[model samples]
Target chain A: MFKDIADVRGKLGQQQYIASEEIGTVVYLAHSLCKPILAEGPAGVGKTELAKAWALSTGMPLIRLQCYEGLDESKALYEWEYAKQMLYTQLLRDTLRNVLGDVNSLAEAASRLAQEEDVFFSENFLLPRPLLTALTSDEPVVLLIDEIDRADVEFEAFLLEVLSDFQVSVPELGTIHAKHQPMVLLTSNNTRELSEALKRRCLYLHIDYPSQDAELEIVRLKVPDLKPALAQQAVAVVHQLRNMDLRKMPSISETLDWARALVALNASSIDEKTLTNTLTVLLKYETDVQKARRMMGGGDDGGRHGRYNR
Target chain B: MDNRVVEFIRGLRAAGVRVSLAESVDAMHAVESLGITNKEVFRSSLRATLVKEHDDFAAFEELFPLYFGSGGPPLQSAMDDMSPEEQEMMQMALSALSGRMQQLLDWLSSGEGPSKEELEEMARRAGVEWANSPQEGRWVTRRMLQQMGFAQLEEQMQQLYEKLQEMGMSQEAIEKLMGVVEANREALAEQVAQRVGQQIAEQRANRPEDLHGSDLMHKPLQSLTEEDANQLRKEVQRLVMQMRSRAALRRKRGNKGKFDPKSTIRANLRNGGVPIELKFKKKKLKPSLVLICDVSTSMRAVAEFMLRLTYELQDQVARARSFAFNSDMQEISVTLSGRRAADAVTQVLYDIPPGSYATDLGNSLNTFSKKFMDAVDGRTTVVILGDGRNNHNSPRIDLMKDLQRRAKRLVWFNPEPQRQWGTGDSDMLEYYPVCDSVSVVRNLAQLATAVDRLLTER
Candidate 1:
């Protein structure tokens, strides 16, 4: 457990995640209150990374559930091991016949088979997925539901019921409650609006683009071999690009990658030619690269491309 | 539950942040666990519990300080820094001022204005209870401040500064005092505004639900402001979800797909392959769409909104390819992917500057047929969103016929009234024969109805 908000920052810092005061405070309260934290922002701002850092800092086993469209309960929560159950029934067919061999009436024999139905539906045949694993774990864990916005709205309904109570009901084995309620962190890219009912049960944390100084620190920490001045220049350029209203703003990890790429190339300065060569590392979209080059001025070869030529 | 936190939640709600009762309860729980001794934690506790959307983060940041910050200016008073002899001289100079100025100086020097009750009374007297909206709250606060003599109070502070100079106080001392006085006056004005805002929020919280949906659906798209557009974006998202759930229920009721042997065997596992109960697959009813929109100035709002709705419902459709044009066309399917529809609209609208709008649907259709002819197939439903005023250009009826031939069906949503069709340059009459359906979609209700027909008639 965190001693205080600052302790959260300190512990997470040791794990190499530089948390802002808001992030630290939210993490602290999430631990104390035992509410899920719905961390949302633009991609690559470390919404997922923060969850990882928290789990590491707290020494909790991390269980991640990656969400996509049409995500459903059988995949996320639990699934019946039908093949295993079927194989068991086949192997035990003669043994079952022996138990029912002395039955006089057909009705009594059917009842005897009915009494043994629980053997297949029991916990041995229930394969626990991330949600059920996190809930049923003996020790506390950090359940990270990554990119939850990508999941269908119906999946959110399944979640709304499960999150309100840290328990899952299997018809044969009854309700399996959490021995230690796992700290849940759900990250979103803000691509789709999450239902308000789900938000109501969770603590909401919005992580935007970090401050310039923070980015500088992050770059230096991640790519220690990079020159200090080049790191500063890279952070400054990222800040400038963030305000250009481009399709995709460069995220923190992109900045770090740029720094690392610059180091790998043994580059000491961030000049126009160097930036053009390394721009692809920062921006994924060809249009975004052109826009960044256009904004950087001195419209070089990258900016002269016909489609987005200014 | 803390009263102050409750009041802050009310302020957030009235500010349109939509903090629900469950969120407020969570906020109180967070605050209790975190404790209020650390102000940053306290703030984060409230924010994490109450604000769930990035759009509301700014409002929370703005209102948090106003609710939780200490009631004092950031400036320090010169009197605190002054020697006893100099302070006495300054005191005498302020005391020499008479009536309202003297009383004002006394309050400013004390670093406290009228108490909460007094401020509330003044705002009540300013009719803040009658101020229903935040804009009206601003008006009431301004009036309340003026009535409280804040305007004259500025002049009084100026007079005091002159008196200090006349009384032989140092120039530096006088400047320092001025900073404190200005800061106090600004703080006093803010207090009035905050109190008025709170009262209005209190009144709003009592009256309940937001005014949404019905009127907005009937209101024409062109008249909606940016805020209304944002609200409508949420409405569209909700509409898609509602329509999806309803579709799901309908499917669950009667619709069945291919037979599944595995599920049938599993159902009759107890009876050794004696299949009594059977199972059928859930039908996948997703449709593919091709949306071509005229984003000229007159049709821009309608086009933007139509594209926004299409993008929100993209999940329901197996595939959606969108294009925007004024005098030229660009395939925006890539631009609109993996982004919020509202944000994507801004980018698309930015790329296609409204300044060069010529409403040349004829030219755009030619561009589409030449460059994007492969996008349409036998199963595609090509929907055109426009007002159909083609700026006196060629109608290009041959291209429209070709598109209708390639597509499963071509539907047109013309916002212009039927009487206005082909009156001047509109190609609606010419394009009507080629289209499978032409629906008037001036407002959201009509637009939704048209879209519903497009989906259901499939």
Candidate 2:
């Protein structure tokens, strides 16, 4: 429904999510240029969800590559189908015997088989991975390269080549350019600095947490069935949780999850008893729970407990 | 621009021939007076504008030839009648220019060429531009010449053509050479111009273009911009005001607390459980600070960093304060101020009545404690700056002990030699002990560590 970058940003802002200008630019790039957006943010902030939303908005299939350390080209881009390769090898062995090929030295036969492109790395045997699949898909696709920072630098180097030119080089199949270049989005959590060479090729944007009112609206949007009082309490409590010195602060997704959990409890107000029972969903860490409990005065529900008791 | 006095001051600042404001102004004046047509006159004017420090002689040597000696200025000049040494330099200038231009051409053609004269010159000086090439392979050099944003090169080229006419090159040949140069220049200039935007984009893309406090504080993402200095000054103001409030509170501690009769009776009632002692512990607000800063030339890119830190401490710390020097010694703690931290710092080194020489830690510690020892007390903590380059400065242990003896805790933070310490002028060895803790502080990471330790102890 959005006409342009401004429109998209305005629409999102109307939803009260407050997409940063950078995020708006990237969303515009992905939608207008039809490039797969690679979103890299810390766990729980909606990097993966952007792809899903794009797919939902456009009615396209969302193809995701959840990147991890040690992921190589075969797993991420493409691989030869091993079963087909073995079948071809068996057929060649049977036919070669009849064709009087066995008289040649085993070395020569092996070399000949290796040299035959069809017998070696062939297109029929090519198992298209997310990158290749995104390129080859007949329909529009959202290829999400998630958590690329965790991927090895070598993988990043490999990705840079594909990103610069939406073409993958296969020694056997020759170069494969995307039939319709999918919208490419690459993300990083900025755990380590990206190389300058790669940075020059792509348009980049960084996403930060939304403001308090925006976050409250997000909770409402995600869980409209939850009581208004409970939603407000959950947002307030989560906002306070974020300010604490916790190892992993509660992210927006946790914010929604805790709201949903609270709503399921049929709690009209967030009493100390209900809070203690449901604290696990909010604070993932034991130390964080302990710290929160200490702030709450050891679950004693002190004299001035009207806010907590609702 | 022609004021000899202003020029002299700027010249000293331009040491190593790094172009400064005075040079730019002079170049602009030369363009205004002589017209851009006389290449030799223009080159001479530009060179004269920039020639300062002894180190700058090399840069001038590189740029002068490229500007004036590039073409048509033959072996036989009116200088042919002058000194033999003058003639040799002219010959060297011509050949160097030709050779450098050829290298620039080759770099443009191959898209990957070793830094020719043009690239190297631009990289060294701020305003000079021979060619700008980054990333996207060689394009038509002529387009680059036209598009490259540097007006200096264009003005210089106009001078070159005008000088060619003066040198008696035929109009036809001049036109042909101009055509060739113009084509290559335009091509290269366009590419370079495009890359200026790309470089800006690349800088933004690689880092968070906007920092959390970017709008408020104005800290630039890459190089330290004027914005960073302004924002730092703003932050320093806020911090100083906050510290002033805290300091005011510290001063009024006892007077603010009048005896409460109800609390006194409550305390006496507690003695019914046989508690006898009624004691009033004075609210002692201790103030101390330790600053360790990076002063290496590379770190000089963020030279304002330490100045800002010192400015912050001037208000934050309640002290009889002490500062020691490195590489060499001077305590300018009294000179440094939070309000004018950056300028005051620059003023101290380059503008103070008695200017500071190269840093020397050994001499500084001995001098500071010996000269300013009366200022340090049980309430004080020592702050030292420099790369800890003892730089052959003697590490007098006895003086360090005497200084350390005056303070409750000695704190030394070295910007280098993180794990590997006590090498070179970093005689962290001599001062490591008399101090309570010594940290090899580098960047924000180390600063965070030092701040943590200071606050935790507090």
Candidate 3:
């Protein structure tokens, strides 16, 4: 229900998510065009948060499908509740005998029983997963397919149908159409190249690590109680760490965690001692920590630093 | 405006960004709905709809402006900001210019560059359609600029500035007008050059003789330039994706495990113990690999791509330990894990600077067994990528033989052609019988096939 790109930004701000203009514009277009937005970026950026915030801002429910390897239609779309159907069939055996009573010929009894077969395959035995629920919802919702790259290639191909048409086919129920089209966002970590077929159907947004000013604003916004000067220095250091070729780049989530940790430790500003103590909070690897220390002009005796720097 | 967007997409395609028809239509719809009221929104709309790949974004950013920038500078009519008397002075100075110069003056003041059709016609007149490659685009663009008298226009603009002062225009007025003219001329030149070059590229892209990515496949790996190397870097991802889909279609046994009847029965027990839902045995625990690559200048291109594939498809392998050697050897698995593969290759090479240009694969293997013997186990596939020339150094097949005894599969990739094997002090034939498989990989296609065979044959 956002009126414009500015309106999207304003509404998302109400949800405490600071969106860049590019993100706002893309989200607005995806809404207007009824297209899925394929957001690709590094890990721990606010890709999943954007969908959550959009759902909150719009007062729609959030329907999430976490895709992974071996994710198939039975898991993602809809599954037949075979156990329930079997229980019902067992209970209805006497009724079936009564219905088939007084039929003389075997063929006649078989024909008579055939008329009642739709009972078990009806909507009562259908279990709708996230994809089906999103399509068949009576009201519009936000559908987030997270870590789609982790899904097998076949699963990605299967999604193309649901994405392009906003409809899905259930063998018993026929093709189900969306009463209200959901605003869908699919996020990828760029672990692999998505097929051209899938990319062609959706609007694309690449959310890289935020710029320094943006990250500072994000940290200050997300963690309100931190002192402004401390937040500034923390963001500055995280930015420096991001610039380094670490095994794992410290993302915005890590920055926020670092800030919260700094506050919890009662530290007001970053110093050599504090940085070394909290280094584990910012970086994951010992090699990465040593490299950061070396870059901080804090030389260590380990030979790993030599192999890394060279 | 849509015309400009269309040209922009074409220019993007010519620049090797794959903008499909569906994406192009989406871009158009995005633009049409956003309205061009805000240039930033318009740009974002186009980018989000048209560009999908992270790698293509750089191309999109580079070409977006060339198609969408105004022919002239943004300031419209520097004289309009002046007092009425100064405007009259400007009109008088403009009246003295003749024909082309006058038209050029008027166009510059308008801030709308020459029309697209006009640029197209000029490019055609310059015979730029004959240009069949992006590398040749710059040359043809220069020819088009020469034909358009762009060089003379710069000189004439200077003359016009002097004439304005002589005509008694105020110094401030003269300065403003001159600055606008110079900026406008520069913008105009850039506009023409980019458009002409775009046309040449489109011409080349449309031709059937040189398919976009296929050309790189046949070219010898040794002859690949740095630009070609970057292109190959991007292409490697596509190749892998293609192979993945193909493997899925064929149910490639190398990467995927076979049907699990036991697991299928166990899983389907929930449904009357029937086999309506069959399950696949999960792909065998991903096989670990040890890659020994030659980081010598001669093998740099092949080795970089090999690392690129590994970095991209890292999860496919359980654990990979990489070592780079020309003369001295260093374990680079940790180094490669620090960054993306493209930069990782350069980092590894920088870390282990080539020694004497001497390739001692034998000695490197000796060191590998001596210090890092624990890196290899029966589950590891040991792949050594080099020419096997060894620069006449000791070809200690004994070391290779010893390593082979401890490893699962010993595979050697010789980028040298089959005819050249054992031509010099190759040491290829000496180590050949001891190895399980030796693949002759002379070009990208061969390399891809060899890698495919090695990875899938297991």
Candidate 4:
């Protein structure tokens, strides 16, 4: 849908997703080349958000599959609806009796039954999961496999065949190739190393934490009612906290959450009391909160209150 | 695909980034669709196709500027006017250096190894002072290229350009010469950088031993300098990962011993009891480990190393609890439980200062029995890391006997040499009889072997 890199950037911006030139170029290439993209980074850097924004910009349906440890092919690709098949059997009893009425012998009845066996395993009885749905859709889609690192190695190996061929094989229904190839985006949090074979078949993009200017733009975009000065101070404090040795550093989403919280409290700017009260919004762990508190108490320039003094 | 792109891919592979043939083709297609006029788009296209991991991104960034960014301006482009006499003089000067310059370029482009004498001669001609310091060859080659008549060439070109302008030559002729000179300069610089990079790669491939430090596995821990300790720490991490994978493989193989016929039949009942879905017996659970380490000054390095290894291997065990002591015992499982391995090691070191008191194994064991005995059970394997040095205060043989009775087994890792046991206040002999097994672990290799045995035996 994009004419060039600038077109991609502009469209993503129209959807309220601020993309760097690097992201724009990669998205354009992946679109033109008809390849899957593997996006790896720390958590909450908008890896999943990028796919949603792409789907919105292009006006395509988004099919999402959230990955976990025991995910398997039957869950991801397709499964037979056994209960539906059983109900169909009960409803078709009169029809089956009519079809076999002319047959006299038991073998002749069994042969007649075998002739219509494909009815139970047709498309109506086959339930397509995210992978199969994306492949079989008449219109192109945006398929997002989120947190792929949580999936087992066996599941990853299974994904290799689907991603490369854009087709899935059901034992009953033969191989089904994509009618309109969907744009695939797989996001990982680096929980485990993905297989090299899977990585080789796809484009790779790493989205790190945004720069200070980009982050300030994100804060303003996310929490628009907040004053510019308060947003800047909150971003500056988050930047400082990231530099410190904490168990879990605050991600970009946390920064936005903190900014929104500050705006809700009717605070004009960040100060010691405001920051201390809203610390939980930024940090998840008590140890981190205590550390941030100690850092504030040490009065290294009188903590967040120092911003007001400046 | 352009040959320049192929050469850039070669450079990337040499720098330890794995770029497969399919990826290279993909990169070519990407670059073709998105033309190379825009620098940002071109770079991002290649990066998305060629680089896979986060660590390889740094290597890609370093190689990009050297390969694709070399096609820009040279120094002489800024000076574009010269007089007739100065132009003549510049021509004569270039003729004088032409032969040696051609020879240098030929040697560089030959793709054959040049001797030290030839390299030194080239440096001398370029007016680069070859420093005797042991620095990287790439840096030295870059310095030589900068010093080589590049600055003089710019000055001479400017003088000649002005001299030609004053003598009424056409603007087009002077502009053409300027472009030629600029192209030549860039080509020379690129050739030099490529040669130096190749030479460095060759040297590294020739001597692989220099990459890893000298025999870190067998080096005595007590005598380790800070650098040696850092290297050993990295080695220990690698060793721990290998041990963990091996244990996991064993567990996976052990899980297939016998099939549960009941589960198989019940699971396949939907398919008319043909037993399509066979279920095997679950693997035996891995035993938990409780480590009691001596963190006094004498045993600090080895003890910390052991703790780091055990913590890294925690995934292979059912559960792991760590305790540290100098003169008294402290259960540190809470401190080290959920943190990163490096961070946990740092926290343990900070929490337990290396006390100056003599090694008091007896007192530490007594404290463990009195306070943390509830942590011990028949399923827990107790690993005691110390030299068994008690300073002759008390051997604590009775406490050792008690621990052995309660735990499944007691394994003692003595950092001191075995021959030195029971001599000079060492208490290994007294504690050896009560312990189920005793191993002398003076270095990382020995420690790894002992740990491997412990893991496999379980």
Give the winner by TM-score: 1
Q: What is the two-chain DockQ of model 3?
A: 0.59
Report the interface RMSD that candidate 1 achieves against the true structure, in angstroms. Answer: 3.4
True contacts kept of each: 0.73, 0.00, 0.77, 0.71
Preferred candidate (DockQ higher): 1 or 2: 1
Candidate 4 local lDDT, B61-162, one digit each (tens): 866766676433323332235455545544553454455453332232222324556655665554334331114555667676654545466665666567
Give each prediction's root-mean-square deviation over alpha carbons: 4.5, 26.3, 5.1, 8.4
Clashes of each: 0, 46, 1, 11
* Clashes in predicted model 4: 11
TM-score-best of 2 and 3: 3
Model 2, range B1-458, lDDT digits (tens) per residue?
24432343233332223355534554555445444465544444344344422223544543333223332111111332334553343334334344445345333322343334554344324322322222221332333433333334545446555665665655665465455545655555544433332332223223422433435333332244554544445454444444444444444454345445555555656334222334444456666664444344423544455555565565456463434343434455655632234545675444222223455556666666667677667876666554555556566778778777877677766655565566655666667777777765555445545645654464
After the best TM-score superposition of candidate 4, give how far the Cα of residue B399 lies from its true spot, in angstroms.
Answer: 5.5
Model 1, span B210-259: residue lDDT tens? 55788888888888976677677667767776776665455445458888
TM-scores for chain A over all candidates:
0.93, 0.83, 0.93, 0.95
* TM-score for each candidate, following the candidate numbering: 0.86, 0.43, 0.84, 0.72
**Ranking by lDDT, best first?**
1, 3, 4, 2
Model 1, A175-251: lDDT tens per residue? 88899999999998877678889998999888989989998998888889998988899899989888765677889
Any residue pairs clashing in model 3, and if so which? B71-B113
DockQ for the candidates, in order: 0.50, 0.01, 0.59, 0.40
Which structure among the candidates has the greatest lDDT?
Answer: 1
Q: List the candidates ranked by DockQ, beginning with the highest.
A: 3, 1, 4, 2
